[model samples]
Target chain A: MFDDRSPIYRQIADQIKDDVLRGVLAADEQVMSTNQYAAYYRINPATAAKAFQQLVDEGVIYKRRGVGMFVTAGAQARLRDGRRERFFAEVLEPMAAEARALGIAAADIVARIHQLIPGDSR
Target chain B: MITTSALQVRFGDTTALHPLDLDLPGERIYGLLGRNGAGKTTLLSVLAGFRKPSAGAVLFDGAPVFENVRSTSRICLIRDDGMVGDGTDNLRDVLDMAAMLRPAFDSGYAAELLDRFGLTRKQRLGALSRGQRSAFAIVVGLASRAPLTMFDEAHLGMDAANRQLFHDELLRDYLAHPRTFVLSTHLIEEQSPLFEQVLILHEGRLLLQSDLDELRERGVSVTGPAQVVDDFVYGLKVLSERTLGPTKQVTVFGGLDDERRALAGRYALELGPVAVQDLFIHLTGGVP
Candidate 1:
């Protein structure tokens, strides 16, 4: 199911990007056609096509003419770097702010972070 | 392309549809939504050439649709009453008639759909259950492959699972062969996503018509402390509002631009998109 906070096409593009960053969709691998994705998700084909167009515009995927769309070379690494830059502002910042509101100190948050990732140094 | 210009229909003293103008291009599915007795059937019937509009015209590619053989053959309307005729006819007879009358009807596809829906060729129309009758109607609709197909509450008798199956099959066939499909139904939440555009009818008038995505973008819910929520929603068209203790949630109708979103972020407000069904309910005054 998709949420309405943004257009479904934008969400579709984001999901593909996440897959690329996680290496679930390897670079140069053929992606599902717009029709296939539309059928799978029970959405309009045009909506799915819009998502594909956005991904193509971002250089995340490229069309192989009649065959289908394929993940562009280095798409995974590019997505990873972009996500890394956003991780702090989109995830950590709000989380740290929530912790502060709840009277948890920065040191305590750091210690909890360390507890979660035992081998990592902050 | 189907275009209606100032179209209106009246029965005796009651106006079923007020003068309305609409243009529906080919190759896209449209959702026609309205409450009971909202003139949805009247509009579709006019489009299908089953009835003549009292005023203005319903045109298919610049030609009038009413009583025109060329246009009527290309337009298919399947109503909830199962337009397959009386119960005396068997499935085979009905399909045979469809093949004889409908130029685009595919008999092979009809057979495949019958088998998929667990229907038999020898079964009489009267013997099938309500759900099966609905399924058979869908079979006729899809296999007809008419350029402009309209299903007006055709799934009323179907169960939730069967309705979902119908949606899937409709989408699959639509993708395989693109055409114009107008679905008039009360199941807004379940079917709205399948539509590229949606037209809402209220009190025999065209209330709103827009791309589904654009309609979705018009509604948003902002929740935070009462003061902050009030400040953010001020001067905006607020559809509905709720308050619990010191927290408030306001559903507003309009695009949430970046500046307004940033303002919400500054206030730590939780902003979320409103579902199409919820927005519809709010727009229609929660008549249900």
Candidate 2:
């Protein structure tokens, strides 16, 4: 769950972003309070709060003061934009390198992607 | 800063702790893990100034803590025995005392904590169940928020849910205000994540004190065909091993790099982590 190469809080923040983009969490929706997240995840609340702070810094979430953290009104768009920017590093680049090693052409992969979208006639 | 020099403790003929030295920097949660009678309690007691070391001194910020009210006031130690006071005192009095004496005490938070723990102010400390006592101790430990707070098995009687609550509250309170928290517990795996640094004691001796994250990265487990794993582990320190059917799992403590990984892969060996508890048991000679 934790890697030595990077701070755990950053990884936690990244995971939260992935969740937000995947629609596992909704914008303007209240997220788990830091204490709730810490206990639920069995991690230090400070570390959890750091992760939330990272989201706040990135405008991915906003704090409601005495209440708790809520996904911002445009949280989904911000998350999608942020994730799209990193898609190549996180997904495409690795897949492309592996495919090249396997002698699979980029066109072949694109064809597979379109084939998997059964209703996308275009 | 907290420093102990040549600290020694002896209970009659049994030496509880040998002459030792240690230094703890400011504002970090330290996990003091050891088996029973491994001197955790003794060390914490001395550091908290509840007991004077038989041979040596404990200093807080360069000043001796023993009999030093100013220094002692900055520290709160919650042990299984609770505080030495009128056991008849209701929980409210204890909270009041904490709020009045502890410079950083959070009375409002303490009240909320009491409610969360289902402990009422009017309840006498003596009348409370063991679990309730544990809860009460934890409340004091968290709410005190002293510069240095030590909890020595302070929640031994708490149920799993309440223990979870205790950990959550501890972290939340620490974040709200950072301080030095030293927790001594036998439940290593349960509390390992809370620790930035771990000080492990074995048979009254300081075994290791290192960054918990780094300690975790020092060992790896390799499993594969018996011959391959054996060859890879040859000349390497084997901490433990288990064999069943056609495969063997060997735990080796050392570096595992890309080269080692490729070698293991070539030999059809699988590499994984050695759980902290299993490693601790191996390190401590299976003490309790």
Most DockQ-accurate candidate? 1
DockQ of each: 0.69, 0.17
Q: Residue B129: error of model 2 in Å?
A: 0.5
In angstroms, the error of model 1 at A122 is: 4.9
Q: What does candidate 2's lDDT look like per residue over B1-288, in tens digits? A: 999899898889998889888999988889998877789999998899989889988999999998999999999999877552368999988888888888888888889999999999999989988888889988988888899999998878889999989988887777668899999987877887787788988888899997765677777888987877898999887888889888999888765778888888667577787667777777787543
* TM-score per candidate: 0.96, 0.76
lDDT of 2 by residue, A6-111 (tens): 3456778888887788888788888888868766676766567778998999888899989999887777887788778989886998799799899998999989
Residue B178 CA displacement from its true place in model 1, Å: 1.3
Best by lDDT: 1
Candidate 1 local Cα displacement, residue B63, angstroms = 1.1
